[model samples]
Target: MPINADYKYIAAEIEFQKAETGAQKMKALRNMLSTAPTHKGAERLRADIKRRIAQLKDEIVKTKKQGKGRSFAIKREGAAQIVFIGLPNSGKSTLLSKLSSKKIKVADYEFTTTKPEVASIKFENIWLQAIEVPAVHEGYAEHKQGRQFLAIVRSADFVVVVVKEFRDIAKIQAELKKANILLRKTKEMIRFEQHMPHMVITWKDFNKKNLVRELWKAQHKIRVQTRAGHKIAPKPIVLQEGATVETVAKTIHKDMIRKFRFAKVRGPSAAFKDQQVGLEHVLKDTDIVEVFMK
Candidate 1:
């Protein structure tokens, strides 16, 4: 059916199309449908729009019946947010109970975790936040609140999943993939090329055990120096290892990592003074690095 071409209505259409989740998109459509002009000329078009809205509402209700749970919207906390996601009875809650003192409900039945819970995992100087998301069952996979739960996972800095021997990680991966979340990866970083940028680029091959250290180091501050031997009083830009030439980027934007045509490094990770490196070179802690755009 044809929607009104008014500027305000067009904006609403854009919002609906751009919405990432089904619930969010449905809400957007309803809001747009409300602005329909109440003239006889627009009656049929408006009626069609209302019918579509009703169908969306029905779909949402049917999905909720499959997996009944309250909508969840948890604010991210700590240095990094990692979560446990798996099939029902996959031990997500049990794993969280063992990791921290937080008392979580643990049960042998599927969908025991009625809600998401967070716990802290202390690693030396840093504390990593771990969350246990309620189990997902094939039957309840389309529940309205499932989008909200998956939203939490999508915003997470890392993912730590629990699974049984028979649990299909592939299926789990497919479900989470719909949320634009990654199950496995080795690298995450920001790329800089003078004026233009390629947005925040991530690489492959990440391990979960060292994530605490990896997250800490990748999100910490870096002390940067210029190519002219001019000390700019480094402000600590956080970046990960093996940044090679342009390694001093930040994930949190606490500081800026200048990208030059070439960079020089002088530290234990380097073989000699002012050793030139590429963006693929790994960096070491407390290393002295210099950048040049000219």
Candidate 2:
């Protein structure tokens, strides 16, 4: 499948958060804002990213003030860090309350959340951490406040943009664009092929005629290269239908890709088969992957 530009931004942000320098962090933030969807749904994300950038700047200042010998970095924890971004009164507190065990201040007004908050959510056997940041206005990043917020945005694993049903979507989009975020629409694709119930295989062709046969070809393929441009080959792993990038990484190698860098989609998005793409690219059934390192 062809990877959309929006997905690329998300993938870049995830990779940037793992970086240790202010310059790389800012570059990743720029990519995220440049590729995020410019819609009401993306408004929250715009705010969150802006806030994170500001926070990052503040960290740099603090580090400089403390002297260059001190390292300024955020220690990552949990399998995933989901960041909730939205405007004031966008139901972020409400949603967080329902999703995790953390107790956050919930109210009916704006700016209720003045800082970022973290919580733990357990899904099946996996425990994920969620981060909630302060609400931001349009064009916030152009100012000192926005620069301070960027610190938090650059550290999150994934972003959840929240918006109300009846809101000024255009205005929200304008704000997101000002922050350099691009918002795009996405649709789900489903594929059915006759293959082993659970196994991984790589094929040169994924045309409709050979779809059934591709399903049965199962042999572990080692990810020789990563999407983030890493050289080392990870462990051989199997790809299952509907498996998420994170799950795929676990099977490949331990500590290979800290989080999903980005995913390249192959087989069945367009007329071309074996299409390559970035991490933000959502995977369809029977998609071949070369997992990237973070």
Error of 2 at 217 (Å): 25
RMSD (Å) per prediction:
16.7, 19.1
lDDT of 2 at 140: 58
Which runs of model 2 end up more than 4 angstroms from their true locations?
A: 1-74, 166-169, 188-294
What C-alpha lDDT do the candidate models reach, one value each? 0.57, 0.51
lDDT for model 1: 0.57
Report lDDT (Cα) of residue 261, candidate 1: 52
Task: Give the winner by lDDT.
Answer: 1
Tens-place lDDT digits, model 1, residues 25-110: 78777867786566776787578768878988898889878985545765544445676777877666766675566789987777
Residues 1-294, candidate 2: write the lDDT tens digits: 112223365355555655557767887787777776677756877788789889988987887798754222344544555566676677767766766777899987788987677777654333456677777677756766554554555455455555664243445445545655534432421111121122111122223234322222222122212232332222112233444555555443334355445555454431354454443344443445555444
TM-score of each: 0.45, 0.41
